[model samples]
Target chain A: MASIKDVAKEAGVSVATVSRVMNNRGYISKETRRKVEKAMEAIDYHPNQIARALQRSQSYFIGIIVPDSNHPFFSDLIKYVEMRANEKNYKLLICNSLEDPEKEANYISMLRQNQVDGIIMCSHTMNIESYKKVTFPIVSFDRFISPNIPCVGSDNFRGGELATEHLIQSGCKRLLHISGPLDLDILSNRRRDAFVITCMKYGVAYDIIEGAHNKLTFDYFWSFITEKLSPEELHKYDGIFCSNDIVAYALYIYAQQQGLQVPEQLKIIGYDNHSFTRMLQNPKLTTIMQPSDRIGSMLTNTLIQMIEAEEDDPHVNNTTVDVTLIKGDTT
Target chain B: MASIKDVAKEAGVSVATVSRVMNNRGYISKETRRKVEKAMEAIDYHPNQIARALQRSQSYFIGIIVPDSNHPFFSDLIKYVEMRANEKNYKLLICNSLEDPEKEANYISMLRQNQVDGIIMCSHTMNIESYKKVTFPIVSFDRFISPNIPCVGSDNFRGGELATEHLIQSGCKRLLHISGPLDLDILSNRRRDAFVITCMKYGVAYDIIEGAHNKLTFDYFWSFITEKLSPEELHKYDGIFCSNDIVAYALYIYAQQQGLQVPEQLKIIGYDNHSFTRMLQNPKLTTIMQPSDRIGSMLTNTLIQMIEAEEDDPHVNNTTVDVTLIKGDTT
Candidate 1:
């Protein structure tokens, strides 16, 4: 509750002298600085940070915009980014867009208005053109927006191929692929395409079941799986590839409820080797590891580099981390 | 890249007039406002927020500190808080403490230095005394630090009683409870107490299994479950209550891998009805549903109320929401 004037009065010095010492902006003797420090400690005087930022012209904050934080993938990404940002002595502001473009745009403007140093966007709902008008630096994760902006992601195509080949090598004949909403050109779509091609190369029949677009709800996923896979059709498939582990785990539970034997009647695989896979009732999910933590750190490092680099430089390349298939009991 | 000088020239007004209009701090005629707007659009001008913030004392931003976003409970909480904060015309800065007291303390100082108006803390690692030095208004979630500060959480005792009574009614003879980190005295301990007392009432033998301390990691959980539950112990206990759904899922998978029949031989229940629970291999988790989204909104609303209240008379309260018991095949 102590103010600068109170500290100055206690130190027996002018308020300007105390201000100079606090801001480190003007010359002050060591004796005067010591007196001010003693006064501040005695009174438990904490400077008003809001007033300090006004003088510095920098908030020293960054914004992270995610589609949905509840999704394990984005949550893991946020953790890594926050860790890296902390290391660089920057505070992170998080905005959840919930896959709504209007919300995403609003957050972008809000971050700008709050004077954030830069923004890292994980939501693809907003238009790239809108971002072109932004004055601050932007780095996107798992999304390709503009040619000028940097993006970070895993090699989805290769990951898909590896998962499909693993299933085929395990003697899976007829396969089914469950994917996320198909509208966004996320790297995940590339994996889906590679999955189909890999299945075709092995002379296996494959079917695709598309979940509701951008609908990450559990109920929606359950309804989608039940409506797509009937009891008779379920018996015809020997392999199942899910876009993410959450869906694969759901499929596993639904299959068990229907009395179908796992790995014998159906082999299930998923993307994003989330912690949930290891905690499942069967621990039978075979999934592709997306290296979420590494991707998040790399993206933060890259964005920092971009912010520090000259604006006209064009040498930086988009980053794509590697992915590997994790074989589990389902395979 | 267009500056205020350029806009002023285009609008045939003085630079001071343009600045006043942009900040909305000074009187301006309707015609002048319209002219400035047209000039800004014509030149595609965007204000440099950093430069503008230097003129104002506050940054118009709030800080949010959480344990980890990857956890479904925290993710849902972050989403609701962000939504409510956005509606109130404030931007959110997010920090992940990773359940480390040092990291949590560091984030608090960083946010303070960055000039955030207030902070919403969901991390429970740091000591309550550490927060007394903070000058900004802080609202804690799920953890009570001091009587003077406002805290928000669900009715832990009631929820614990409901979960334990449900298990007892299911006719379980022997039970085991898996808990989160033990350092923080919050909902988990309350649940543990209720479980023991409820089991004692029925003359059922029960034991407590401390899964991990302070930090929840997959490696810690995997080893804890495997080491604590030997094949012999698995048959002795017919029911298990996990502090959180994540631990419950891990127990389910570990039990299944050891060839144990769930519900038939062993029943498992968890807290925090996360989306991942429905995605389990056998739907083998009956859990207590904590209203995470509601908690987030309620916390934000309370903080905003405190922030806007008269500085001389800040209000503080300890509020507890309700929790529901969700039934599933696991029990």
Candidate 2:
């Protein structure tokens, strides 16, 4: 609980001298600095971060807004974001927006009030106007909120192409693509577009099913897929490409429950090579690895740069990382 | 960007009056308060949280240290913790210790410097001396750092008992219990104790394989399990009880690769009933479910109470939540 004044008294120096030593500003004699350091150590004087951040107008805190941390994809994203943020001596204030626009807005305001160095927007529930009006630094993930804010994501179109090409190469004549709500106008819709374009180019019949966006509950999407694609309908497709690994996992479980053969009867490919993809039995999931770690590091570095940049400096450019197709037993 | 001075100038009030209105402290005229509120709205003024926190000697922030958020068990634990923390108007600064003592110590110091109201220690790489010296309030999860610190965790013994009893009832004469490193003296060791006692009571032969603590990489533990139990040895055991769902998942993958049947030829049970457990194919994993959400709420509330309580108040008692045996196709 010792303050700078206490350290100053112990060191037989003025409070201003102690402040200068703590901030490492202005000139100070070596003996005086050594005495102050010794006194600080003797009294266990830990400088208050709040006071220092107030002076510098920076909190060294980054806010990460995600829909749900329990979801496999978000879990990985959060893990990497925290890791990279920690590497730079920054702490992450992780807020789960729960896909609520109002909640996301409130969190953004909270982050601003605390003067966080920057915010990483992994959830896209808020409108573009809110982001445009934000005075603090913000870097979006997958979704481009406005031209002012930079976004970081993988090549979703290429990811879709890789997935569809893998399925077609496996001799799948009819394909099914299950994805998130395409009406959201998010970057991930590019995957669906690529899926359709690739299917048409290959002269293959394909159908698409769109589920609600940001719906973390797996059963909701599972029941939707089952209700829409019946046993007879499912029998028509020799391949299925899910938007993410979790959905593909649900599909794999559903197929197992139905006693349907994989690869031979239905080849499956998923996006986001999540850890659970390898845990599947009989046939492991073939997936598209979205370079999550790369994206996290890039996002963190970009946000930090934006935070440290001069007020009138130009914004950082958007980043698009590449994706890889990982072939497992499913294909 | 509007400071209190701007609000005061626009409201035609003294700076002290504006500060009083913002903090809701001291008596102020109703007309003056209304004018100040209107000024704040018109100027889009957000009172600096860092300055307010410094004045109040509180940050309203809780630090959470976990081994890895990507891990299924920790992900669920973190999601619930963040949700509960947010409900109480506390933001969570998530720190991934990566099971490194040095990293954990640095995070503790950083959290202290920031004047976090409390810290939730879910990763236990630090020594008792560190926890004892933490001047801020702290709550341990799944580990007892000191008698003075309140801990919140599920009943490991009961979880163990449930898994063992289910496997025995499934007609498994021989069983194997795979667990984390038992040398860490963590509360989870109680599960191993319960397993031994339960097996003795049923006169069932059981063996155990201890893996490194917090080693999230599945291949490392999988290789160890393979080294300990060869195919010939695995053939002798009709059931396996894993300490957690993640380890059970790795075991399931190994079993599938080895061409061993689940539930019929071999019954498997896991602890923690993670989301991936039910997502497993064929014999969905039957497992024990820890009351993670309840534990999270209890931990957050207790920490907030300790933070708000008088310094002379006695420490809160540790809490142990009940566990449930969720029956699935695995057993």
Candidate 3:
């Protein structure tokens, strides 16, 4: 491999001059720059990114900490995040924390050791102190750590309001709301809060069912609807509001097997309009559409700005983008 | 940030001696190593990974090239790949090439420039020559680029044969096969080849409908079955074999909406039993299951071996793991 010294020798320039030209730190004559460029091309000298990153203290890399990329929500989020990051010449270092606090902390330290420019935290298992102590730029998804660490997510409260009000308007008397465990300090709890408030405001009776764990799993959705909710128990509700599209899909199967008339005897709505759910076209689950692409763009843009801006500047504030209702066949 | 020189001075050792201790080079007394380690901890010194990587030419990074992480197939593959890679102390740098030749080419060069230890190719858009020119360790998924680059994939031929034979044994007179474009030189094409052979051996009539593009999309599956296949056109087959689970799910929806009974009048089976498909548990999707976790483990393990082992040794050969048939209500 040709070294910088070789390029400098070919360009008739000092090693220091070549360094300046490569880093573009110091001013150089046009002819000198042209000669260095020509020499580099002639020798096919590829600049060392690690060396350059070390010198400039910029790795041009973004570390993404997600619970699991296999989940539809995280998969779509990771997809858009990687695209925006790659478009900006930033690579993504994926760390699947599996929602484990110890693993999350270890990944955080590892990413820091790797000198990533910024980190996008989609998994939050540790306390706020862990994130508050981090001096580097961090942009979180759904979860709010501290006031200084900005959080990016959808308008969960409004999303709940739209789904609840739409269900009521569609002639649903009683509703069953199934969601993930509400114990975690996540921003999505605002949706549950809104559901309760809306039900009371409309003078309609509603009940909530929490998952066995903090995350959404196929087994959780499948078991609850099929085994837990017997025909007698299911007859209590005329409508259902699920935390995610997967639950809505499971309910769709349960209703089909039970011979329950949809939109006539029961109405169902779900959250997070995932692309994977598009195959459910016959009776598409009505869902709340979270703009994954826009959110990804926002998170990357915010993190990059934080990385570029001076440290002493005031911290960037949190962001909550809008969510819309995608009316499908179920409702 | 305390430097190595500070640690050396604190330990009353020369800088070169400290370097030798840190790198585990040549020999060093146990007492001397202890002194260096204690001094390093006392001064709170963290080794500069960038500098160390520059010297060792190993970044402890494995670049993952996938078409898109949002796709269930790629998402599951990436999830398992990241898990296995992380367990081995290798961070993943994800590249979603979107199946574009130009983007794939750019990602290859970028991963190379970043000095990734090895690459796991899940997306192949470029010609085989492009991969042949790469001197670094590369392990491919599904696509066989060349004999030099080892490939890891499910036994796609076996998976197809199992699905076809099951359909035939179930007493299907005519079979409809839905698959991705066969123009691409992918190992999965063996599935199509087996599907034809199995149908012929059983003396069953089989017709294939290729995707409008190289990849599966909701629009293609949705439009073709619902809008394109009129009731008269759809009555020609007793069973359907889909290339993926998503297409099978789409057929499920189309059949129900068209008032066609499943497994009774028309049997359907899909490929790649994804976790997301588990919610289809009522009349569950009878499909061929590819071991995503095993494939991921095999790919990463193979690539890491090629990285750690001698480069001069004969290149590691291709690996094909087993696939199983997942029987559900659809069959």
Candidate 4:
């Protein structure tokens, strides 16, 4: 009798790969599956106890991986994702990777073992190569992990353009853009691109500031901004555009401390019109409102589509939602 | 052999209850279990196929039910819960009940079917009776769901006392406490009780303003506050203690619009020293910080303890964590 090990050797792949193919689990390519099946048939391999639980039961579970659920943006994403998944009668298993790649890997393996139907990944702690190997259907939020994974996000470039243009129109001669880490290859970089291009087009004297890895909390952001830019230096720029509302809020606090009057001595615009931003009535935050509800809805729908689609179906598609400029007291 | 229906009829309970007892799934009391066992013996009932999955395997999945994860308080709770659960090698299944009892019921049923080991319930939409019927090990956060179910929350009364006393010491002549709906049977109502007691102790005149249903979002709160009190009337109270930081922030906005200096004209204190409140550096919120992280850890630990305990274990226990008055610029 041929053993599973013999079949793997015959297939020119690892034994674990053969086991994954046999169980119809994880991201085994069609070509790889065919090769494994061919090798099994050639070797006349038969398992003593074939656990078909992976393919037998539909868990109706979707795993959501986020960097940190407590973050305002991700919390909104989680809420909408849960709502949309509920609409489709799918339960969600939330994993907060906490910016740890090892934890994310463990979560992925756990989700697979529990037979989750799909995953909606928002965390970018893990490398692309790791995501490429996932067998379950996945759709990323605001990131391009691989061609095999679909990505959904708002128009970051347009958001940046709108904010910069609004500040320019508000009659600010000197401009400054505060952004997240621009080094990451995420789609959000388009926002920075638009910021530079729009500033160049308007020929405004502008400089850009970046956060440490673009993941600083509000307190850290406050300290970073204060440490990097002195009150006098910050006053040099009459208009500021923060990458997100969180950072913009830090800037607001800094401006208040510096006794710089908003929209008089300086004007500011933020991105991601989060719920907290709406409560700011001092000078209501004029922000680029990312369609968070719509983006969450779209991501869940895309994951569900991929989950329900046939294996031969086209696996990946990129979708971009529109963003709107909300004019508030800031501009 | 007697059928399952016969056993339930003899026990004077529903067939579903019998099934739950057989599977050891939800919150069947020791008395109820004994009654069911007696009925089975009396009727000579034999569970066909005896799907004794009760002692079979541990799912190591904990279900979390919350009204809205996007809410700052709940988001903080969820993050800490996830972190603690991860430390224990347990995965979380998050459900946004959306303030609907039906959705919560459905989620409970689904989680039971999926063999979740325990549940940490934060939503108040479901009635106490509904929670009492649950078969899984359960812990209620900030709500006293049932005497049999353990609850974990902060010392709301002490928190209220600290906030109120701080306001008095700050030399505010007249005081007002804006609280959540006082009619609900929730533990948080103690904050209101302490507020009244402390005000009376200090011989200070204070008024109480209640929100509708104890569930107001930022937008709803803004409208409620504006409609209920004119800016001129609001200035009458020299000190105000809001139920939560969200309302305090709205008050701050109101103060700015009305040209009332925070702490100088009106000393203000809020509860739930949430992250957003910390970011409000202009007049940083002097609020009572609910020990959210400690509460989350305690709740997870309590649930895990109950899950791992044997049938004869006296597992039910209520625990309250302490709250702190974080002095910010408002006071």
iRMS values for every prediction: 3.2, 1.9, 1.8, 10.2
Candidate 1 per-residue lDDT, tens place, A1-331, comes to 7999999999999999998987666789899999998898788676855455546645557788888776777777888888898888667888888878988887887687666768898888776788877766788887787777788889989988998888888899888888777777776788889988998888988998875554556666677788888878888888989888877876877887788878887888988876456455355578999998899898888877766576656455789999988888777
**Tens-place lDDT digits, model 2, residues B91-140:** 99998888889889888888988889999999987777878987778999
**Superposed model 1: Cα runs more than 4 Å off:** A1-58, A199-211, A229-236, A254-260, B1-57, B179-182, B199-206, B209-211, B214-216, B229-235, B253-261
TM-score for candidate 2, please give it. Answer: 0.90
Clash count of each predicted structure:
3, 0, 0, 6
Measure candidate 3: CA RMSD.
4.6
Q: Best DockQ goes to which candidate? A: 2
How high is the lDDT of residue A62 in model 2? 94
Residue-by-residue lDDT tens digits, candidate 2, A285-328:
78999877899899999998888787756569999999998878
Clashes of 4: 6
10 residues in a row with least lDDT, candidate 2 chain B: B275-284
Return whichever of 2 and 3 wins on lDDT: 3
lDDT of 4 by residue, A1-331 (tens): 6888998899999999999986557999999999998897687564422022223545678999998888778888888999999888788889988778889977887677567789999888788898897766999988998788999999999999999999999899999988877656688888888989999998988998875554526788888889988988998999999888878878887898799888788898999987667666666788999978999999999999998787746566899999999988776
lDDT of 3 by residue, B1-331 (tens): 7999999999999999999987667889999999998898688677867777898888888999988777777888888899998888789999999889989988987888788999999887788888998888999999989887899999999998999999999999999888766778898888888999999998999998774333436676677667656776677888999888877877877787777889898999998887656555655799998888899899999999999886566569899999999999987
Model 2: pairs clashing at backbone N, Cα or C within 3 Å: none
Question: Between which residue pairs do clashes occur in model 1?
Answer: A93-B93, A93-B94, B181-B214
Clashing pairs in 3: none
Residue-wise lDDT of candidate 1 within B1-331, one digit each (tens)? 7889999999999999998887676789999999998898799776756445446634557788988776667777887888898888767778888878988977887677666778999888888788877767788887877766788988777777787788788887888888666667765578888888888887888898865753335556677787888878877888899888877777777777778888788888888876566455365479898898789888898878777677745867778899999888888
Candidate 4: lDDT of B70?
83
Give TM-scores of the second chain, every candidate: 0.84, 0.88, 0.87, 0.81
